[model samples]
Target: MGRNRISGVIPSSLGNLQMLNDIDLSRNALVGSIPTSFANFGYLFSMDLSNNELNGSIPKEILNLPSLSTFFILYNNFLSRPLPQEVRFLEWVGTIDLSGNHLSGNISMSIGMCKSLEKLLKANNMFSGPIPDTLVEVKGLETLDLSSNELSDSIPPEIRNLNAL
Candidate 1:
């Protein structure tokens, strides 16, 4: 469900839907961290939990889902802490949006391992440190928005090599 007035935490029992391919729970009043049981979704391709009251760091298992190739959107939530390094496992994911949250720490260098990533939106958070040069490895990246954060240092000159940007 999306754009609803639904409130409260997402039920962890939802994870039992092993055949699920897509789930949209955006624009709700849901609170609490993402249920780790969600890792059980073997066929999940897209998930949108954005604009909610959810908090806590993302579960690494969610990022490691091999079938999660379409997109994963968790923006505009209260989620915090460094993005899990397991993000490197999303080798076939096309887009990832973690913007408008309280997430902090250096953007993981492992992000470059997302070989099929095309759009990575991580603006308006508390992330700090220099933009990782490894980002250049995402040669298909076309929309990378790391703005409105505490990032420092100069833009990596190597980023110019991303012909898709």
Candidate 2:
């Protein structure tokens, strides 16, 4: 349904599509919460619910997907909250864009565990505190944008050492 102005709630039962490999509901007017049942899609590896009115934190099970490689939910109306801990375990995620939301929390040190992380766009949120030193472990990280936030603490000078690591 190209160019269809989809509105209203996404049917929760759509998550039952077990063999689903990808879902692209972006660039639409879909409202309401993302169905938690979608986590049951074992083959689900890519999802894009961006540019919508979806609120609340992302379902934790979405992160637990062993094959999830790209999780992009940027440009939504979701509120401030910490990223799920299990998300740090994604071994193939090369990029994560949680930008333009109300997300506020300490940047988890566990982000370092996502060794495959390359592009991380977290700008325009209420995220506070200092950057975690462990982020240096993401050797593939090429872009990190955290501008426009209440980040109060000064970035330690030692953070510059990440360039050498």
**Highest-TM-score candidate:** 1
Candidate 1 yields a Cα-based lDDT of 0.95
Candidate 2 deviant stretches above 4 angstroms: 1-3, 156-165
Q: Kindly state the number of residue pairs that clash in model 1.
A: 0
Model 2, TM vs. native: 0.87
Find the candidate with the highest lDDT and give its number: 1
Candidate 1 runs further than 4 Å off:
none
Clashing pairs in 2: 80-102
lDDT of 2 by residue, 1-165 (tens): 213689888898888898987788887788777788888878877777777777777677777667767765555566457777776867677778888888888877788888887777788888889887777788777778888877777675655655523
Clashes by residue pair, model 1: none
Candidate 1, 42-119: lDDT as tens digits: 999999999999999999988878899999999999999999899999899999999999999999999999999999
lDDT of each: 0.95, 0.75
